[model samples]
Target: MSPPPPDRLARWLCHPHFFKVVLLLALVISAPTVAIGFYADDYVLLSYLAGRIPGSPPWYDLYNFFDGDALKLQANLVSGFPWWTDPGLKLHLVRPLASALFTLEHAVFGHAPLGYHLVSIALYVALVAAAGRLFLRVLPGATGALALFLFAVCDNHLHPVGWIACQHLLLAALPAVLGLLAYLRYREEGWRPGRYLGPLGLGVGLLGGEAALGGAAYWIAYQLAGPVPPGRAAGLRARAAAALPALGLLAYFAAYKAVGGGAANTGGYVDPLASPLRFAAAAAERLPVLLGDALVSMPADLTSALPSGPFVAVGLAAVAGLALLYRACLPAIPERERAALRWLVPGALLALVTSLGGFPGSRLLLLPSLGIAPLLAVVILRGLRRGPSPGRAAWPRRAGAGLLAAVHVAIAPLLFLAATASSADIARKLEGVARTAELGAPPRERAFIAAASDPMVTIYPQAILGLASPDALPCWSALSMARASHRLTRTGPSSFTLEPLGRTMLTGAFETLYRAPSAPIPRGYQVTQCGATIRVAEVEDGKPSRLEVDLGAPLEDPGLALLSWRDGRLRRMALPAIGEAVELPWSPGPIGLL
Candidate 1:
């Protein structure tokens, strides 16, 4: 059997009208989001809007919700933060454009979630279209079309599109992509308007979110590696002019710091400007994981699920193997495609660096995927065409390419489809948990969650309740966030100690989300919240080994109720009597897998 002619094959692979397909795929994949109501930070945003969570900024300034000290006071009052939360924890962000959008949506839609989901879907579709346009500009023909297709169906879009709070990711991406497209036009077509429009678009993107910094990386990459104009002086001038857009990043950073907008005292987020070394360390640790995710189909979210040492090691190995595989296959790639690779590879890596401020997740891959999609498309297309041909000398490269193609082309789409459904289902489950908490807890009684596998189950329910009925908001404390079996020993009439059977508290990835390594809780440290005092009883390896909780009431008090997550459900559990010990089994609740 003979392969089809080159032109025929190219025709089959390329779609000149790929944007339409991208739009359709975006719509189809994101349709399930309409069923997903408020989850995680969406509840917090809504609660703030409802005036339930005090100290939050006005609607337009809502992105600065974590900036004020008043919120910390409010958190202490209601046990909003976990017991392990850093005393000076700050998760401030400057995103006026995204905040304004949220404000506008809430004013118009109020509590009806259908409107928010629709807006998020619309933004996502726009972002996909923008990305397709950018790809077509940089990588023409079959490669560009394939890149658009790969990006359109990428599972990374699931979170940004489905989760309302994550709309900022979409908002940031859309303008950033447009800016890159404009910059490309300036470099490739000599468009005068593009020089100004490119910088303008990036500036607007910065207003959307800090994720916009990734766009500046592409600008830098183009200046460094993109094709130069005919005259040497003219090319230098053009490249120098391209630096204007990157200035937006500097300006954004300056303004952000001026306004006291940045995350601090949290292991989950590292501020690059404030703590450069720590940020570099985090980026170094996270970059490989993100690279593995982009190069192959290794889910970036696994960083949270698995131990850091093993996960980072495996990710680093995958990155090294993929780099070598790409190097082996590079000679087979056309010079034009290889030229694109020079910029694409660097742009993708730099974009990934921009996202390392937060924990690695599929959601953060959106910006990097812009460059990776095209790079992968070119490699995969060339590999498929040449690797399987008879008399190929590079059998090793062929096998490596074949494996890459199998994972990305065959398996990735199925994972995307599954992720689309899974994202919606996770939101539904979280909402269910919030609803259960609202109904199960008595109006006046304080609730204590004995054990919850996921932090979302513990933190967000109170905010959800505040949104639903602020007047009757219940105070609840999550005793344990670890997904491990524990031995609950009753120490006194009003105090109980929880010791994990095999692990120390606040050591897991999710557990560390609330506490930074720099602000470790001392053994005798105590936090009083909602009539209960939580004390760090014992420490092991710099982590809490035993946590003693003083309920301020007898275990048999009818005013207090104990709840434990079991079999994916939050159910009331019997309190251990004084001098009694009870075993608490680990259960991955609805959002645990996420």
Candidate 2:
């Protein structure tokens, strides 16, 4: 029943058990989709990319956010970014190939919620299946199976995998894992020119999710740590050929910089000005959070059940467990993969340290978990390898293995259900707001809509649909309005605001332009369907100027004034009549409700 060497991959990927596990995990983890719908970012990004909204993000719009001279009303326009739309910031493009996936998907799915959801699920299963084969090949018997099952049922993945907009992570990860698996296969057989395809896929996958870059890192580490096979000279030559694509990527980055791609702001973490101690401390503080998020649940998710004192203890203990497992299993591991253990350290570092930069969400942990899963599987398999021999010690080892397996089996499904439940909760709230946008979306200028409950869902509550295109009257989030009030004080409305936040205030759907902040102010600011800034309240000695200007209501436009009120709250003001103008006193900061 043993699979042939070449057929090894097929055995894991095509096995009946893989299918069964995928089905069960899908039912458990994605059961929430029954109630789940498009969420905050999904409505905006998907619609725009699919050109379902006015002022859609054209191809290469990500960089346009940085391009000062880029087209007007481009959703991502950055009029005056301090960094000048640095190329490092748009690192998202490394996975630009993923956009093609979305394009094809929407062509078939046509933005149907069911279609997007199913596609997302299918990609998730595909990623886990590919990862399962790689782990099975690398790790000892039965280890990759358990690790893959845990990966399928992994708690953190629910948010990233279940959410459609977040499917980029899945798309990026699949190719990365595939590339690494292909590298391993080539390492076993002789490397050929076709092996170069592995690196090419990796390069594309990197753009999908930067975490996929780990696949390239892994290949490098494998060559370094793995013992050279016979014909070492020729073997490395073949690998060198495969490595050319990655080298070309590096060359591309160098060329990218030559083209004015802004330098990465490593100053925050890696700068000489930054205190090394503080950097490590900050990274340290985040490490536990990343670990906790990956190993169990987020602090927010566990706050009530697990108190701060015990939470730290559990987090540390979890860390301690890994260290101990590595020490215990270091001896039994096959020598070739034994050196490969070093990969786990960086992998853990990557998973844990990434938290220092961004918000500590489970999404951040997905890539690191990909690394962590194999390491954990190796240790578990290593321990089982030593135990359950045919002797007095056999029962003890068998009992231990059974207990460990039972815990993984039981906890996996529970974590999956918990992930689905958490998703369901967020979905319920977003559904009401999405419905509002679809039904009550306004059709004219000088208008804003209050979100049902979520503060982050910006723009109108509705998206208008036509046979070929979609349109809605311009709108504002509270943040957008505050930004408008602040920018009008200096740059005036219609001119591109030089600052980044001010830049977002200008949605590209409508035409508007402004002079620089230092330039002369216009008579008044006006955007056709959106509202305009009429005047700025001058402030001297920090006292409020409270300037007054009239915002005329358009006959066809919704006569709502977007205002920022006390405690950073935002609300809309209604005009008495369509032709009436609201003359209001305003300060330099965000304006408030009348």
Candidate 3:
């Protein structure tokens, strides 16, 4: 007796060797990341591990890199905090498991970046495997394979995989999927060990990173909508057992708050414990944007490019459209697949809520992608089976499915490859900036950048230089991060007033990362650090318009080096004579990932 067409297709899709092909495709697509080298915060972490940065936490607690007092100290010592940074800013994260892994890797790999890249790639492969197992368990057969393919090819994973510091996302996601799978087994198959294993995985995920909070959403969703064992008492017991994981989440939160580990008084991150109302508002605004990005391929980073009003409106419209299409296609989908979506849709929504504590980006969509991938896969599969000619009445569903298939199947793979290349390009550009700074200026000179398009160019070069030579560590203080040309008027031998060619300062996306809008720097504010003094000389619309910098030496002093980003490289700028005015042109540079 032969099986039906659907069964035959399911067997073909689930063939043991087909999954290997998917894995291979993913590996090939992401292979470029292995050569990207250290980027952004990787330099900072490396310098701290090498004891080059004073007042840094011990190796085991390396991720606790920012706190109010610590930032003040670092600002004083090395000009670590940019001039625009808020004095009251507190952005601290505690990820012990990730720290421990870094410690071990540092011990073995030393400063070589290739070793770290290899480790990150290994973790990425493991995460992909875990996601495949998860899709199989929940959706099964052809649908599961399609989901795995969609997930494996997603470009969003590039950030976590390419950047060594972001491996915690992978670390958190692997156990999270496994934990959910274990919980499902315990409920559906009467497995005894899964009860404890489920919570254990959740606890480990918390240790991995705070992003693991997304895992708790799946547990909650399963408890609400997942299949229940036969009999009233048995079903009740299964549901009650699910609550055990919440204890782990509570313990994690309690410990995190006790250690004073959370974002505070910053617009970049909203701590639910400290400011519940603010967090709620942020989550609401971010949810639609995240959903639109995950479902219909809208870029979530558009929040940075577009004004809040228009961006949120577009995002809301996208979400509404996707919801309608999902509803239209629901009846045609198999009951088993429909059952999976019951929990997966809500689970993905809840998971997205967990990511709202920080800024919105596609990188934060990893856990949510778990639910999204299966949903998209099933819908695309249904559309393909129905063929293209389903009449005008079904045009909307056909169009929606076609759009999704085009985005995920064709465009996403290309984007994944481009993202890998972009990471490498960013690493190269940052290295160029570091090397240019190192060669152009005198050794041990106190360097102050007159103007740069991005803050990473100002801060990262110092860390990169420090890692190269700890004894002769480089010191750099940024005067402005506004993406505008500047008029440098030398008021005195040691003082100059820098007026931006544009209206205001610190308005760019990278600049605001250090100082959020909620805590704006007032005019007449002054700070002296690293042999230089900075004052906000004028204000425009509550943001600085001009900055006055006193270098503590004559304008032509050999010990002073004036640098600015130009033509894709950091170059030494000639100091202006006293009472002379010069225009410092600003050239846009690569906006590296954070």
Candidate 2, which ten residues in sequence have the lowest lDDT sum?
Answer: 509-518
Clashing pairs in 3: none
Residue-pair clashes, model 2? 15
> Under the 3 Å rule for N, CA and C atoms, how many clashes does model 3 have?
0
List RMSD in Å for every model shown: 2.5, 10.1, 2.9
* lDDT winner between candidates 1 and 3: 3
**lDDT on C-alpha atoms for all candidate structures:** 0.77, 0.48, 0.78
Residue-level lDDT of model 1, residues 384-428, one tens digit each, is 555445475566666776787677667776787787677678777
Q: Which stretches of candidate 2 lie over 4 Å from their true place?
A: 1-35, 50-55, 59-94, 191-194, 231-245, 252-288, 299-317, 328-340, 344-360, 380-409, 434-444, 448-455, 459-471, 479-558, 561-594
Model 3 Cα shift for residue 561 (angstroms): 0.9
Clashing residue pair totals per candidate (backbone < 3 A): 0, 15, 0
Q: Pick the candidate with the highest lDDT.
A: 3
Better of 2 and 3 by lDDT: 3
What digit string (tens of lDDT, one per residue) describes model 3 on residues 64-166?
7667674555454463567667766677788888888988988999888888888887877777888888888878689999899999888777788888988
